[model samples]
Target chain A: MFLAVTGFAILRLHSLFAVVMLSGVYSLIAAAMFVALDAVDVAFTEAAVGAGISTVLMVGALSLTKQREKIPVHTPLLPMVVVLVTGAALIYGTFDMPNFGDPDAPANRYLVDRYIQESPKEIGIPNIVTSVLASYRGFDTLGEVTVIFTAGVAVLMLIGGARRRRRPDSRAGPEATRE
Target chain B: MTFVLAHLNYWVVVVLMMIGLYIVVSRGNLIKKIVGLNIFQTSVFLLYISLAKVAGGTAPIADERFTVYANPLPHVLILTAIVVGVATTSLGLALVVRIREAYGTIEEDEIDLQDDEE
Candidate 1:
């Protein structure tokens, strides 16, 4: 439901506001699902990154401009059909997903369990998620930080830099010329 | 009430999350986008807090009394996440202010049109 609604919003909404909100909706749903799966840490990170900070920045961009201008809209039928087919395929794939909280599930039996059981002695962190995110995947986290930093720098250098001055008042310029 | 409250955190998170997402996607105003972002970030806080609960455990302070304790790990993780969230928001807002100054408009289409003219 979250993905479907948000997908529609991203597709159909002309204004940036609706699109950002729909994206937030998508993140929120994912957070809930994370909790249901007993992955609280992932849920927390997603909620913060997906819902909170991103939305605020996007909306801030919405200010200082004319609210959406109306335009002749296209139906976008082909994209919708493609999305529907993709969604159906994804749902079909989920049939092979382990039941909710299955102890014997491959996911449970392998990676997460190994981390939970072995990390205590290895990395010495009580929280498996933290250990996984910080230690084993430390390089990935660093890369993510670098990406964000680069994005910030790129936006600043590109869109956030100096403004072009507007033309001087025509009347004032003409009066000065006449004088 | 407590039981419902515990379970309903998910729903609350969902609603707030959507509201934020809608603002970010549908709105052209950059400030509105940031506000939506904040709302979305808050939803994650709710999810973490819900999972951190130990049902019958007290606050995580290790004292002589209140033996049962809610998990401390989630709280610690959330604190870091909160810092990161703040950092991102400030950066994003800074970007928006700059965008407005440069483009002279916050509307995405307007900016694009202005760029095309340039």
Candidate 2:
């Protein structure tokens, strides 16, 4: 309910600054909910990345862009209809899903049992989530790290080239005059 | 009544997802669109975490005192995903900045208008 309110608030707000702040608050509330759902690690990450890092990045972006969302001119009827239809389909699809916390649901069975039962001895790590993330699925984490590194390099290159080009002020003088 | 109670989280997730989608589709501002994308992404994360829950389970830390733990696999996956989400978000913002530099406007309509003249 809290998250839903935050989402709606974000939708209604025109100020990008308020939107960014609400998003951070939304993430904080989501992190709290994650704790309720038995995903402490995810909650931690979401608080840091979704709330902390993303908010900072968005503020930085807003510094370079407009602060207010322009009131859209169109009626947006088509998009509203499309969203309603898609939402209805999603709700219908949820009918077949296991109840919120059924222990015997297909996803909670099989290898999950194995991992939980054996991880203590096999990996000798008390935290099954950590063991699985750092050991069982180490390669995936490595790839994800590589991806973050690539993103960093890509941002630098994209922004770096622009800065370098700006330094050649004499050339920009001619272009500015021609325009 | 039981059905609604059983799937409460899912219903909320769907609503949130739709809200995000609506913002993304209806809004013309580029920054607003990115905020919508963030909302959309967060809702998906909520869905995954909700699915990983076990009614009586504790957190996925191993202990003899605890008999059941929520599925750790999804937690692991979501952790990685959250990191990736931030990375992509930063990248997208960088692109937006570059676009603003080139076009001198971040309004989608304005950009389209400028393109049409060219």
Candidate 3:
């Protein structure tokens, strides 16, 4: 589909700017796909985070680095073989997975019933997803927020300062400032 | 034919995953590798959403008109994951910036050569 095509474009393009834009497009298409697959909440998050924030961050990163990818000197044969084997293995494993969208699949069974049935009575939320994410899995959300917080702190520490280097050969910038 | 149709979504996802993997493993550019990693992670999100489908289901929002709601668990999980993926991506990019500042080049082979000489 669109994702496959966009992914291919990203792979083939040497220009980091184009690749970054395509990645944003890929994320938007993925958000559309999520909407089609009954995941509106996920679609919203993907649209904002994947397409919006990630794209900006990448462009910022690209500004700090080279624009064009060098033509790889080594043949991609080994990586090609590895990807083929891994892909084949994954496709083979999919045979055991319940057919796409089967309601009775393990993924749709079990705690799902509890979340759907009990959530209304227990959480008093009209939206089952909200109930589950906010109440049932509140701790998980807290942890996810914590993860984002940690990442923010890490990014700030990594690149927040505009430290000056006396010489290009001076190794003190990254090592000395890094803690 | 039915089998292929049934699993068509998965096959596409697998292809996307492979492409991402190839980019990561084959390319020397650090930024390119990070973009590859983004592709890989997005495909995984697709796989999860695909699995959450229930044929004749509406979005996980509960409504009286709709009896079937797609799995809510995966939606919740993937929502968190998307955010986390961005977090990790920003982190990776930060490291790339640092690497560029430190080494004066972002090519893996060039960095390797520099390391070998030292």
Candidate 4:
């Protein structure tokens, strides 16, 4: 119910500011849903990243652009049709997926058992999620961190570098004056 | 009826995904499109977490008493994905900021029109 309402609100709203606020609300609701699904770590990260960091970054971006969306000129029919067809195909695909919480599901059959049985001894961590994320998948986690680092660099280059070179003469400078 | 109820979460996920896709496709505002992309990514996150669940099992914590643990692999994978999502979103937004500075408008049609004139 919350998800439906939030998704609809995001669709209906045109004010970019209000939409960003609603997206934060959506993320919080999603974090709560994650908690219900027994993914505490995921919930924590979602709350921090989705609700916190992204909202802040979005507001920062919003400050640099128009606050309201201009009315769309083109008809939305084509996009609606495309979305409907794609959604229908995804629903059809889901029919073959194993039922919720089926222990014998293919995803749970092989490596999961070993992780459950031996992670405690192998990694000496009580939380198997952390153990798997940090130890068993250390290389993957490193790559993820690298991705984040690269993103930071990219954002800095895109937003920061431009401001620096755009105005070299002013004493007050562009950054301090813009804000 | 049983089949529908059994996969209710998936259906909800699908609904959310379509909504996101619609926003991305129809909205002219770049920031709104990014918001939609976030919603779409989130629905995928829910799908993965839902699949990782095991009936009557606790979180994947190693302990003597609890034998059944939800699959930890999906949780691990989604954690990485969520981080990646944030990175992509921020980068996209930064690009939007730059677009506004260069073109003097964030609306897609307006930017295209400005480009045509130049």
Candidate 5:
């Protein structure tokens, strides 16, 4: 219920600061939901990443730009129609999916049994999530880590690194010309 | 009635996904768009986690007393995804900051207008 309310608030609110704050609240709520669903690790990550780091980064970005959204000149009707159609289609599609927590579901039926059954003998880890992530899917985790590294480098190159060099000269030129 | 009841969680998730999609499509503010994107990504994470659940199962830890365990694969996959999400978000915000520096405004329409004039 709170998640829905947060999403709605984010949708209706125009103040960028308020939106940022609400989105953080939304993430925290999402983390709590993850906990209820028995995904403690996911909840931890969501709280740390979604609520913590992302909020801080967004605030940093906000500091560089205007806070209030300009009143939109275009009508929102077209977007609204598109969203409703897409949403309806998605809901219809979910009718074919397995029930919420069916053990016999295809997602649960496949290699999961092997992971659950043999992982203790093979990897000898108490936590299956940690064992699989670190051993069974180590390469994928490495790739993900590399992707994060690349993103950090890319962000540094894009804004943090280049902006300093350009700030002293080009900053005045653009705003002056715009005015 | 059982079907609807059983799938209520999915329905709520779908609604959240649509709200995210709506924000992405309608909002022109670059930062707001990124927030929308985050919401969309989070909904996807929810869908996967929900799919991984087992009725009356504990977290995927090996315990002699607890035989039923939630699927660990999805949890592992989503861990990676959450990391990727944060990385993408930071990069996106970085781009937005640079956009503001280059264009003098973060509004998409205004940025386009500025580009046309230039």
Candidate 6:
């Protein structure tokens, strides 16, 4: 219900502001769902990331462009077909899934329980999930952070190529006023 | 926690996750795509927090006789994920801004057509 409504808001809206606001609503609901699951910490993070910073950045992006479409739009049929097929395959695969939260599930028998029990002693943190993500899964986290850093660098390179104008008539700079 | 973890809500969250992921994958509008991405990320947060709960555990606060509080680990990990999500969204939006500035279009399909024209 929440997702459907938000998706409708985002997809139906032509205005960038409306789309961004709808996205905020989507995030806020997600955060609430997280809290309902007893994940207070996750809720906090969702609010900060999904509802706050991302919305601001989207609005900023909107400021740089026309909010309304200036060209004819075609429905993306190829991607839609591909996604639908993949989703069907995924649903078929899930028939083999262990029922949700089944105690005898293979995952429960694995290291997650062990980490929850021993992390307090080994890492001495109140949050076992942190110990797993930072200490045990430190290598993966390092990789993730590196990916973010590399992405930031890549974007800088792409957008910062602004000094040498590709064309003399590309007058979209801050100083250029449309008469 | 008792009823929520046991039944109904769990399935709802799962459905919400799938819908979010679907929108993110299927949308062509860059901003709509980002909104979908937010939904996808939040669904994972729900999954993590749900898994972090203990059946009869207390909240993880320093109180006497409440040694077996629900694990605080999921919360901390989610906090980090949240920060990462925010940064990614902002970067995505910033890229959209630059794309608009350079190409004067925001729709992915339109941008591709423009590239073909060039």
Q: What lDDT is obtained when candidate 4 is compared to the true structure?
A: 0.91
* List of clashing residue pairs for candidate 3: none
A1-179: candidate 6 lDDT, tens digit per residue? 67557766665566768878888888888778666655666666677767887777777667666676433355657656765676566555554555444545554455555665677788887665567678887886787788678767766665566434446677464424432
Q: Model 1: how far is B100 from its true place, Å?
A: 9.3
lDDT of 5 by residue, B27-117 (tens): 8999999999999999999999999999999988888898888999999999999999999999998898878878888999988998899
- DockQ of candidate 2 (2 decimals): 0.79
Clashing pairs in 4: none
Candidate with better DockQ, 1 vs 6:
6
Q: All models, DockQ values?
A: 0.11, 0.79, 0.79, 0.76, 0.84, 0.34
lDDT for residue A138 in candidate 3, whole number 0-100: 95
lDDT for position B64 in model 6: 46
lDDT of 1: 0.56
TM-score of chain A of each: 0.71, 0.91, 0.89, 0.92, 0.90, 0.80
Q: How far is candidate 3 from the true structure (C-alpha RMSD, Å)?
A: 3.4
Native interface contacts kept by each candidate, as a fraction = 0.08, 0.89, 0.90, 0.83, 0.84, 0.32
Instruction: Please report, as a residue range, the 10-residue window in candidate 6 chain A with the lowest summed lDDT.
Output: A170-179
Q: Model 1 over residues A1-179: C-alpha lDDT tens digits?
A: 45445544554566656666766776677677556544466567677766676666555545433345344244445544554564455445444544332345443344543554466578775565566567877775676677567667865664434333323432222213444
| Model 3 DockQ, alpha carbons vs. true complex | 0.79
- Please give the C-alpha DockQ score of model 6: 0.34
**Which regions of candidate 5 deviate over 4 angstroms?**
A167-179
Fnat for model 4 comes to 0.83
List, residue by residue over A1-179, the lDDT tens digit for candidate 5.
78889999999999999999999999999999999989888999999999999999898778777899877788999999998998889999999999989998999888998898889889988888988999999999999989999998999899756545564556553324544
Scored against the true structure, residue A146 in model 5 reaches a CA lDDT of 98
The global Cα lDDT (0 to 1) of model 2 is 0.90
Query: For this target, which candidate reaches the highest DockQ against the unseen true structure?
Result: 5
Q: Residue B1 in candidate 3 has what lDDT? A: 92
Candidate 4 residues A1-179, lDDT tens each?
A: 69878999999899999999999999999999988888888999999999999999999888777799988888999999999999999999999999988899999897999999999999888999999999999999999999999999999999887686555553332345766
Error of 4 at B29 (Å): 0.2
lDDT of each: 0.56, 0.90, 0.88, 0.91, 0.89, 0.65
Better of 1 and 5 by lDDT: 5
lDDT of 3 by residue, A1-179 (tens): 88898999999899889999999999999999999998999998899889999999898788767789898899999999999999999999989889988999988998998888778889887788888888889999999999999999998887765344335445443344554
- The DockQ-based order of candidates, best leading, equals 5, 3, 2, 4, 6, 1
